[model samples]
Target: MADETRATALRVGASEIRADAQAKAEGREAYAADCYPQGLLWAGAVRPGARHGLAHARIRSIDTRMATAMPGVVKVLTARDVPGTNRQGIVHKDMPVLADQKLRYAGDPVALVIAESPEALRAALCRVEVELEPLPAVCDPVAALATNAPRLHEERADNLLGAAEIRRGDGAEALASCDVVVAGEYSTPVQAHGFIETENGVACYAPDGTLTLTLSTQAPFRDRLEIAHALGLPFERIRVIAPCLGGGFGGKDGATVQCLLALAALNSGGRPVKMHWDREENLLAGYRRHACRIEYRLGARHDGTLQALHCRLVYDTGAYAHLGAEVMALGMEHAGGALSHPQCSDRRSVRLHQ
Candidate 1:
């Protein structure tokens, strides 16, 4: 028995076996996506521009009458149905839980539906029609920076979400003194998280008014405050439970279904509410890594000694500021190469556009 116990004990520099490996390999381990509580209602959001290609538009009206009349649908909620501020974000509270006025992106939620069944949820969501007045949309980062470009957020003056500059020493002067200089322009496209599990969660509002959520998320603790602020619930009354995630890759670092699920629970008549973003919906609404354009200029002496580095980075943060400034800051920090440089200057801009 002692020998068997020793075999399972952890040791330094030893290959520690994962306890859940066997269950996962056998498809027996239950993930958050696998959670379906009894008496749970299905919740889904209606994105006005998802199928119509209207990236930028003014929401004229949201028709939820037909959806509300559905047989199994419990409730159809719009921005007015939201309790509190209805806004949520990490650094900037610019994103609305449900778009009340304007549709900045095709993925912005216009209406939320709660149903007794998945079929009812789908049928009800389809019935929730939205009339939008299309507006000009800027896709490219450079074009978005133009003075005349359309602004996604009216509160902001320009399409630039955030900007920062890092200077170590005399960057341009040192580059001019170098014997060799190389310049290049590089661009990367928007990439999705594509997590196998997608974004899924379940929430319940207890009789004591505690909102408990079980989700497959990377930032469970942060989700608590996001839900609280969006739904007007007290932070102490909210509970977030993070189960084993199939994959996150930084995409689940923000609220996905946290606010929506809580909203559903609030109107679910004390029953639990579940929300699962399908493959298409996940691709449509999931947070993406910023697509960026980099203008890099490197200076080196004739003997190959690195002298100075200067780079300008412009990031496309889509229609919302979801950690856009922080992401740009990280890009600027890594602009310098592995070696130390006497002079380095990095400028970064986060653009808000489709």
Candidate 2:
């Protein structure tokens, strides 16, 4: 009788689970992309073609005549259309909202086009002709540090962005006093955030001249200030609302869709403009973790008492200085553990490899 009861219970449980699963099996779940508005305009960016190079491409001639004449085409704007500062950055104002003079990376934006229909937007994007002058590029950070390397920013010396160091005792002297020592090299690779949603947002300009933005962002509050400053609009004039992000992983901490979408909304004629980054665009244009290389040396007494330590850390900050200095500083702080000896030697040094 007990065996019979157990079998019946198992059969009932399976049926219940099947019933719950059937709804999803028939495609009952709804995602955000499934929703459509009565009137929607699609907005997108025209990224630089090269992976790394000097961006001397000037929009020498925009044949927007054909695009504007196309059915459902709204407006085509360039960097010159930007009325404000035209730059965006978290701690430093370096990145351009729209490349007016030069493109820093291959994925940098050169133009923004808005159209009544997705088909129209696609046609307009293709019709837009850009003339670019290709300059020398620095692919490796170590190569960028060479004395003869091309400068990414004219104001900076070489490609080196910044450096940091920490020292305690006489690390060089302690190494001589120690009987045993170990030297090694280590490296870390770049990691992606891999958020499911990628990066996306919608922007609208109200009749009263207020810009409202709904985006999948991590720092919605800071984004508001950044957008306003870059667009040359009053901070109060912009209202940024963030929803549950698909995934961020610190990649979206700075400008992603905020400035571009805001510029789209400004030229959208009070109509809402939406920008959604596809998987390829997200991968190519997205910010990544700093790749690092470390050289370390440790010395100890014959009896195994730690004596001296020295290290040199090199961080590859990629094209832009996105949290590179801060990341290197953190590495320098953790290079060596706490020590208790009075005459012990410890030193840590960091170099930014562009």
Candidate 3:
């Protein structure tokens, strides 16, 4: 093959043509949010309205009677409708797909409303009243570990989810011996993936007792396992198809609408169901990157050679334990020698303050 006549060499300095760029630029791209099939019912989640006031609270009651009676509303579902564990998470299945007994955060889903029309879905969502009993929110990570702070999980003694760390080569002693030592703590806020596509998916319940899910997701295969586990359905019965994402940005890696949409499809009586999160809903219900506080003490030779590194990290997982501990482990391991991240560490309080 001649070098100049080759296909790869035909376009060196010329403008390149892309398959999707033109359509996307001309606003002709078909996104998951734009997926509207015939006779599909609309599903919208009813979130805790109480979070506007408190960082944490207990659900006294979720009043869905008004929503049930609304025109064009098909069904109203709660956690009780979910089967099996009713929990969703890749690494830790601690977060409930729907808040059954209590509302952890203000954005926790308390109700799922299916409607014949989008307008009906909106109206039903507004009518689903949620009464919350306020609790002392563990807003402070350090204070959350206090002897008397409210426990987020009944099984957990304190508010600490868990921790991951690594240590090697007497780094603490090495830091002291180093000619130059720098000790500082840096904190990072909870960052959103902020993808243009806000967790949207379409699901259909087949008459043959199978569920088909089509959506914009980064993890379709994992979503099948999550859906089946949470809904108590046979894993083989759920079919997942991931269309090209409008935007995922890692936010779609976890369960956002997968379980909820499947549940809606189950109750819809073989009808096609669509659940598209609006900007406001996405902002409230979407996944957030861990808000981490990192305390690092770096010691190095005066001649600028890397020597010792000591770091402590605390991450706020918000209401649910997402990939919090794993994220910490990744950062910690990147800086030190191999050490297993701690799981179920027995209580022995360490306080730096007198």
Query: What is the lDDT, from 0 to 100, of the residue 44 in candidate 1?
Result: 97
After superposition, the stretches of candidate 3 with alpha carbons farther than 4 Å from their true spots are: 1-19, 26-28, 49-52, 336-354
The residue-level lDDT of candidate 1 at 148 comes to 92
TM-score of each predicted structure versus truth: 0.95, 0.84, 0.88
Per-residue lDDT tens digits of candidate 3, residues 158-225? 67767544444666677778789888878788788788888888999888998999988988899999
What C-alpha lDDT values do all the predictions have?
0.88, 0.77, 0.78
Looking at candidate 3, the ten consecutive residues that score lowest on lDDT are 345-354
Better of 1 and 3 by TM-score: 1
How many steric overlaps are in each model, in order? 0, 0, 0
- The sequence of per-residue lDDT tens digits that candidate 2 reaches over residues 69-118 is 77777887788899789988877677888777666677788788888877
* Candidate 2: residue 176 Cα off by (Å): 2.2
The C-alpha stretches of model 2 lying farther than 4 A from their native spots are: 1-37, 50-63, 303-305, 337-353
Best by lDDT: 1
Worst 10 residues of 1 by lDDT: 345-354
